[model samples]
Target chain A: MKLKILKSYLNESIQHVSKAISSRTTIPILSGIKLDASPNGLTLTASDTDISIQSFIPAETDGKQIIQLSEKGSIVLPAKFFVEIIRKLPAEDVEIEVRPPFQATLRSGTSEIQMVGLDPEEYPHLPKVEERKVISIASDLLKTMIRQTSFAVSTSETTPILTGVLWTLTNNELKLVSCDRHRLAQRETPMETVGEQQFGNIVISGKTLNELNKILPDQNTLVDIVVSDNQVLFKLDNLLFYSRILDGTYPDTSKLIPQNFQTELVLNTKQLVDSIDRAYLLSREDKTNIVKLVMQDQGSVEISSSSTELGKVTETIPVSRVSGDLLRISFNSKYMLDALKVIDSEQIHLGFTGSMSPIIIQPEGDTKILQLILPYRTTN
Target chain B: MKLKILKSYLNESIQHVSKAISSRTTIPILSGIKLDASPNGLTLTASDTDISIQSFIPAETDGKQIIQLSEKGSIVLPAKFFVEIIRKLPAEDVEIEVRPPFQATLRSGTSEIQMVGLDPEEYPHLPKVEERKVISIASDLLKTMIRQTSFAVSTSETTPILTGVLWTLTNNELKLVSCDRHRLAQRETPMETVGEQQFGNIVISGKTLNELNKILPDQNTLVDIVVSDNQVLFKLDNLLFYSRILDGTYPDTSKLIPQNFQTELVLNTKQLVDSIDRAYLLSREDKTNIVKLVMQDQGSVEISSSSTELGKVTETIPVSRVSGDLLRISFNSKYMLDALKVIDSEQIHLGFTGSMSPIIIQPEGDTKILQLILPYRTTN
Candidate 1:
């Protein structure tokens, strides 16, 4: 491959693909980013079996030439060196030339890097994700949904399917759900679709979703997601992200939410968070993260946590409203804080069925988001 | 102890002293911060046996009442919980009351924390650093001096004294030197002395100096330094930092910088640094950091590094002046980069004694700072 490209564009594309190149990959060619230059443009592809990312830079963009191509070819260069050197290139334009037997030289200003490139033919081929059942969603909305739900994914390898967030689409609505043994988070949003399209049981690795989130555009552009039998593709502006779906079936979490609440209270989100945070500091000392909450009379609630050696912290804050039976419950304060942080509301409504039941929380008057945490059975 | 103190002021002092608290300390009492509240002010102190820090918040400062003292007493609270709780206290002013047997209750707004405090009597007492010699220097200048030399200190604990920076004050000048065997960085500046006062071989741990640098004021206000037999005390506006001097004689490093040179070159500091930086990235892959420098007869220098498996990177930049015979030298690129990064100059003068001799580098037309790096023996 022989081409002269703008350093800025080249650097951005390299970074986009570099995220898929894992340093721990056992395969030698998988540790590199494959580069292909042709009449269409320059495409950079990297993969580590589970996830593959490809970013492209056209020869010309908006009447301005971004690349001057002398020949069409393909080669795979080690991501480690290429990423760093391209970022520190001294000039505005960088020229890359590939000679016989997979040898490439990158020249910019007075600097020249002669790197031993791997044969691109030896690299793994990207999974062909046919555009089967494609659905479009706004980037910002998808990013928010991922943030709200992915944190609850199980990190244990014993339950492999639970390590991914389950995605379901039906009737132009998209929903994402993640649950560990202790806590569960669910976020649902409406997606605009021209036809009746539906897909379910699409479980994507939470770690891969985080990588996609990093490259997701901040703007309100549309992202098309294509779901196949076991492969999912997220198409962005000039970029393609492919994530493998977990093989096992995801557990049904619908029955986990309680249909009725014995006690519910509406409280200021930040105030409750701050009070729980103080109690959390003490609870963390014991490594139990057990903070107790008692629904008090006259629209008030008490939060407390104690360490056997560090003593106790207690605080009472006024709630906007309280209904049904009063109760005392204990739960993981860290999980509560995480749920409260992502709730985009000034007031949150918390519901409890009994002392040992899961605590249900959602933004006041909003049903689009739900977070639940199982209470710890403490022998008061 | 009973006192009502503004949360902001109390939080600031706690943070200042918390730097001295080490969580890994085997001693339980050393993990807590001692609080002494008197009619005059409230003092917070923390120590880890090696270094101690004290911060005082006056009862009133600039016509503002920061503390309202109800009684005078002292107690030690676990730094972990106290620091975090005070920071997230629910009100602007927090009231702390200590009962008999070191049980303390902190009240602010509607929050109450019952903490089991350690007896102040059991806390380690701060060493009295008698003022045998005192010198005043701008806080910014001292911070810069620490940053320039401390990076050269040995991180390995084998030679314990090499982990500290040696301080020498004589002839109305203060000099700081740090050497890790392979490289040495020295910084000096004239000090205003009323009398012929001098101190030498005051070696302070580089780690402690780094902690002290965090709290140093950014302004050009003068900071008082008191040196005693075994300790050094730094007095800031309202903070006192005490550092234990390393109890060993420092090696003589003055002769490492050669007075005469076989080849000399002067070049733009940024350009040379940039060229060397690119070479360092490639050299780092080999884990040897061995980058080669070749001086051209026509006032240009070539910087290159090669990996057996990854190939090579080469860059040449022009120098303003070149004298004597041209030479080729190789050294650890990381050490050279560190030495170059600390030099505060636009133009740097590099002097080479021979292929294997130490390379001397200093700012052009200045004798205040000198850096030396030992060259590596190479077959090619």
Candidate 2:
């Protein structure tokens, strides 16, 4: 294989594919990146059994030439060294030539580097998914949905299914739910689909979603997502991301959210976030990470935390509106802070069913995004 | 103690002192920062035995009030939480009040934080350094000198003195030298001393100097350096930094540098650095980090490295001048790269005595900075 490509284009594509190359892969050939050169373009593929990524650089982009190919072949090079060498090359264009014995030579400017390559046949093949059940969404919107709910996924491996976020589609609405038993985050948005097909119970590992988020462009580009029996594929401009779906069914989290509240308060999001953040500093020393919020009839809330070694902190933030009954509730400040950060509205509505029931939080006038947190039982 | 201080001033002072608070210290009280409020100003001090830093915020500066003190007392608070709390406070002005039994209350806007404080008497006091031997230098120059030589210090604790940079003063010239048995970096600068007092063999740990560098202001302010029996004190405006000197005589490194050379090459510093950097990537995989430089009589140098598994890389960078005899030398590319990054010259002069002798490097037309690296013996 012989090809000449722009250094910038190759560097960007290498970065995207390297995210899927795990350093601790058991298969020796899995640590390398497979490169295929054809008349149309050059493709780079990397996988780690659970996730696979492929990036292509066309021969011509817009009116400028991106790659010039003289021959077509395939080879697998160690991703670790190959990526670094390409990034540090001193020239604008890099030329790569592969020999019969699986040896690749890369030349740029006055530097010439030769690296051993493995046979492309040793690499694993990517999983195939049909495009029949595909949905289209803006790349930025998908990134936001992942960021808002992915953090709530359980990090514990004891329950393997909880480590993934559940994706459900009904009619034209798409919902994502992530729960770690202690707290839950759910985000819903309207998506465009090819056909009127309803799908549910498609659970994807939160880690895979995060990697996909990093590679996705922040611009408003359309991304096509295809869901199959046990595999999902996300197709961007010239990139493809595939991940294996979890085997078990996701638990129903809708019942955990309360429909009505005995107490409700609406306040500025930043002010409440700052108040709880300060109180969290004190509670962190106690290791319980518990902070209490006392709602008063005067339309103000007292946020406080104390530790035996490090005194205490109390903050009073005024609420814009309050209703129902006055109550005192204790919950993990980290969970509250995480939920507050994802809310895009200036003001947030926090509702409490009772002292021990789950608390519901959402943007002031938006019902699409909802966050639920379980209260901690404490003797006061 | 009762005082009202500007949050910005308090936060800056706390940041400076917190650098000396070591989290792994055996003494529990050493993890706290001691705050003393007097009629004149508020003083903050933190010590970790090996180093101590103190910052003072005066009651008034530049005809403006910085602190308002109603009462005078002292207390020590955990530096970790105190620094973070001060940085995140929502108000411009912060009021701190101390009650009986070392309880401190910090109030800013609607937030009130009460933290348990240790008795100030338990904190270690700073060492007393007499002004008998002191030297003055520009803060920027001192930072540059440290950066140029500190990276050469030995990180292994086997030789404690080698882990420090030797500071020598003679004839109003300050010199710093550091060597790790393989490579050495030396920098010298003319200083305006208090008197013609010559001193030598004062070694300070590289880690301490790094911490000091982080806190030093970038402006061209004059810094006072006082040397005692076993301590060195650096005074910069309202800040004082004290560090313990390593016990032992530093080895003489002058003999390692050669005055005459068998081959000489003058080339662009950046070009040679880039070429060798690429070759280093290949050598790094072999665990030797060895890169060979062959000076050609045609005014060009060839840099190359090879590994059995990961082929090789060769780069040819043109030099402006070449003299003496053609020579080939191999050395650790990392040491050469580190030394090149610190030289403040676009053109560098490289001198070689032979294939096995130490090579000398200095900035073109500059005599104040010199670096020496021992060449590796190679079969080719």
Candidate 3:
């Protein structure tokens, strides 16, 4: 294989695919990025047995010759070194020549690097998918949904299913749910489907979702998503991301969500979040990071936290309305803070059941985003 | 003790003193910051046995009332917690009231914190010095000198003295030298001294110098530095830093630097540094991170490194002139790159004694800074 590609174009494509390459992967081949030079352009791919990423650089872009391909073939190069070399290469064009005996030579200006390349046949191929059974969503919406709920996914691999965010599609509505047992975050968005098919309980690892978010741009254009029995594929522009699904069944979490509220208070999200954050400084010395909220009948919410060893803090935030009865509740301030970060709306409604029950936080205008937290019980 | 200080004013002073407090210190009192409130102003001090920092916030600054003192007393609060609390407090004015039995209350608007304060007598007192010997220099230049040579100090405390940078002042010139017996960096500057006292040998820990760099502002203003029998003090503005001097004689490194060169080359400091940095990607895998430079009298200088397991990289950098003989040498690329970083000049002169001897890298225009690197012998 022989190809000459513009340094800038190749560097950009290599960066996108390099995210899937793990330096310490048990599989040695997985640490290398697969490069295929064809007439269309050059395709770079990297995978770690869990998630795979493939990015394509066209032969020409904006009247500039990006790639010149000769004798199309494929080879795997060390992902980390290849990317670093491309970024630091002094010249504008990088020439890659692969000899038949598994030797690849990369040259830019006066610098030449000869690396031992692995046979492309030994590398895993991109997962194939059935096209018709796919859903489409705007890239911006998908990124938002992942960012909103993915943080709640359990990082511990003890329960593998909990490490992934559950993606469900029902009645053209895509729902994303993530929970670490102590707290839960759920987001829903409108999705378009070509065929009338209901999809539910597809577990995608939070790690892969985070990597996908970095690769996806902020454009509002629609992107295709194909979910196979064992793999899920996200197709955007000229890039494709394929991730293997977690094999276990996700626990049903619908019953844990509260359907009604005992007391509801609406206030500016930023003010409420800041007030709780200020209260968090005192509670941080404790293990639970518990901060208390007391709703008053006079439309005021008093935030307070105390550490027996450290000090105590109390702040009052005026609320628009506080009905039902005066109530006080406490919850982990970190969980509440994380939930507040994803709420984009200016106003947010917080629903409290009791001092010991789970409190719900959601944007006032939409039911699509919801955050639940189990309150800490304190003997006042 | 009762006082009201502006949040920002107190926060700034607290930050400077907090640098000396470490929670992991063996002495429990060292983890607390002592606050002394008098009719003059408020003083905050923190110490960790090795270094002590104190900053005073006057009752008024720029003719504005910043700190209102009602009563005069002293108390010590947890440094880390107090800093965070004051930083996040919402109100502009923070009222601090210390009651009997070492209980302090911090109130800002509706937020109130009651923390357990420690007795000020438990905290160590600042060392008193006789106003006999002192030296003054630009704070910015002193900071730069610390940055250039501190990285070369030995991190291991095995030798104890090698972990500190040696300061020698004589003939109105201050010289700083640091070496780990592998690489050495030396920087010299001119200063004014109060007495005709010659510094014999004083070693200050690199860790203390690093912290001082962070706290010291980068300005041309003069900083008063005084050294006693066992302590070094840096006085700037309203802050005072005192660190215990290492108790040992520093090794003489004068003979280690070569005075004459067998071959000399002047090149763009940035280009040579960048080339070595790129070459480091492959060199890092080797045990010594060895990269070879081959000087060609007829052509460019070749930079290459190879690992038996990984492949090899060969890059050439053009030079303006090459004298003496065609030389080949291998050295740790990281050390060379570090020396280049400290040069701070556009053009650098690399003076080589021989293939196995140390190479001196110095700025083209001045001899104020010098970096010496020992060459490594490559097995393969």
Candidate 4:
């Protein structure tokens, strides 16, 4: 394979795909990125069994020749070192030529590097999924959905299915749910799709979701998501991201969500978030990172945490209202903070059933997002 | 102790001294910052045995009222936790009150923290040096002197004295020298002093010098350097830094630096540095990080590195002249890069004796700084 590409454009494409390349995996071929040259453009593919990423640099970009294909072929090169070399090359243009017997030469101005390449055939092939059962969503909305709920997924391998955020799609709305038993985060967004076939639970790993989120540039571009029996694909303009779905049934979490609360309060989201964050610093090193929220007799919420070794901390934020026996509940401040970060409404409503019951938090104006935290019984 | 200090001013002073507090140190009391309140201001000090830093927050700064001290007393509090709490406090002014039994109350707006404090007498006192045998130099220049030579100090503790930079005052100049046997960096700057003593030498640990450098803050203010029999103190404004001097004598490195060379070339410092940086990437994983330079006959320098397992990289940089016969030399690229970073001049002069001799690099117009790197004898 022989090609000429602009250094900047080529470096960016290489870096985007390099995130999927495995550094210390058992499969040595997965550590390299596959380069394929064709009449249309040059495609780079990198994968680590769990997720595969493919980025294409078109032959022409904005009237500038990004990649010129002299000979069409494929070769796999070390992902990290190749990207670093391209970034540091002195010239604006880079020339890559792959010779027979697995040897590739990269040159830019006066700098030249000869690296041993692996046959592209040795690399694992990404599973190809038919596009019949596909749904489209705005890339920006998809990224937001992933970021809002993915953090709540359990990282433990004990229940492999819990490590992935479950995606449930109806005819018009797409729902994303993730929970780690202690807390739950759920987000729903509008989707444009044809046909009314129910796509049951497909647990896509949170790790792959995060990686795809970073690769998708923040824009309003639409992405087609195709789901097969065990593999899923996200297809963007000239990039394709594929991942294997966990093969287990996700636990039904609907029953755990509270249907009613004795008291509810609405307050400015940013103000409440800042107060909670400041209170968090006092108990960050504790095992559960628990902080107590006291519903005062007056219209104020008192946040407090105490450690036997380190002393106690107390902070207060004025709330809109208070009722129902002045309840005090303790929960992980980090989880609450994470939930607060994803809320979009200017005002947030928090509902409490009792001291030990799970609390519900939702953006005041949005019915699509819900956050639930299991409360810990606090004496004071 | 009782005082009220502006959040911004207190935060800065606490940060300046906290650099000397090591959270994982064996000495428990060393992890705390000693705080003293006086009628004039409040003082904060933290130390980790190797280095001690003390900074005073005066009653006023830049037309802003900072501290209001009502009582005079001292106590020690956990440095890391206290600094973080001060940084994130909600209010603009923080009120601190210490009561009997060593309990400190910190109040910032609606936030209140009650932390257990240690007796100030338990904290180790920094050695006080007399100001009579002191010299004054520009703080910026002193920082530069530390940066230029500190990286060359030996990190290995096999030779404890070599881990410190040797500081010598003579001929109205303050000279700093550091070497790890493979390379050496030296710099000298003029200073004003009162003592007529011809010579004095003190080896200050590189670690201590680095911590002191961070607190110096970019300024042209005069910094007083007081050298005593056991400790060295740096006083600038309301901040004082004390460091223990290494007991053993440092070897004389003056003779190791060549007085003359057979080949001399003047080149743009940035260009050479950039080329070396690019070439260094190819040899990063090698034990010696060896990169070779071949002075071509036709005003060009060839930089190359090869690995048996990995591939080979070669690049050439065009130069002004080639004085002597074609010469080849190899050395650690990291050492060369470190030396290049310390040079501030745009143009530099490189002097070489032969293929195996040490190479001397210095700025074109300044005799104050000189760097030497030992050549590696390569078989290739």
* CA RMSD, predictions in order: 1.2, 1.3, 1.7, 1.8
TM-score (chain A only) for the predictions, listed in order: 0.98, 0.98, 0.97, 0.96
Q: Which ten residues in a row have the lowest lDDT in candidate 1 chain B?
A: B253-262
Residue B241 accuracy (lDDT) in model 3: 96
Residue pairs with colliding backbones in model 2 are none
Best lDDT goes to which candidate?
Answer: 1
Candidate 3 on B275-375: residue-level lDDT in tens? 78778888886665789999976657888988665688888888866566678999999888888887789888888988989988888868899999899
Model 4 docking tier (incorrect/acceptable/medium/high): medium
Docking class of 3: medium
Model 2 ranges with Cα > 4 A deviation: none
On residues A317-355, what C-alpha lDDT tens digit does candidate 1 reach at each position? 998989899899999999999999999999999999999
Clashing pairs in 4: none
Ranking by TM-score: 1, 2, 3, 4
Question: For residues B1-380, what per-residue lDDT tens digits would candidate 4 score against the true structure?
Answer: 89888899889989899999887899888889999888778889998888899998888778868888878899998887788889988889999999997899999988889888999988887787876678888888889999999999999999999999999988888899999999999998876667654456699999889988998867888888888888999998999999999989899899999887888777777778877777788788455589998888778888888766557788887875446557788988989999989899988888899878999989987888999999998886
- The global C-alpha lDDT for each of the candidates, from Candidate 1 onward, is 0.94, 0.93, 0.87, 0.86
* DockQ score of the complex predicted as candidate 4: 0.73
Write down the C-alpha DockQ for each prediction.
Answer: 0.82, 0.83, 0.69, 0.73
What DockQ does model 2 achieve?
0.83
Each prediction's TM-score against the native? 0.98, 0.98, 0.97, 0.97
TM-score of chain A of 4: 0.96
Question: Of models 1 and 4, which has the larger lDDT?
Answer: 1
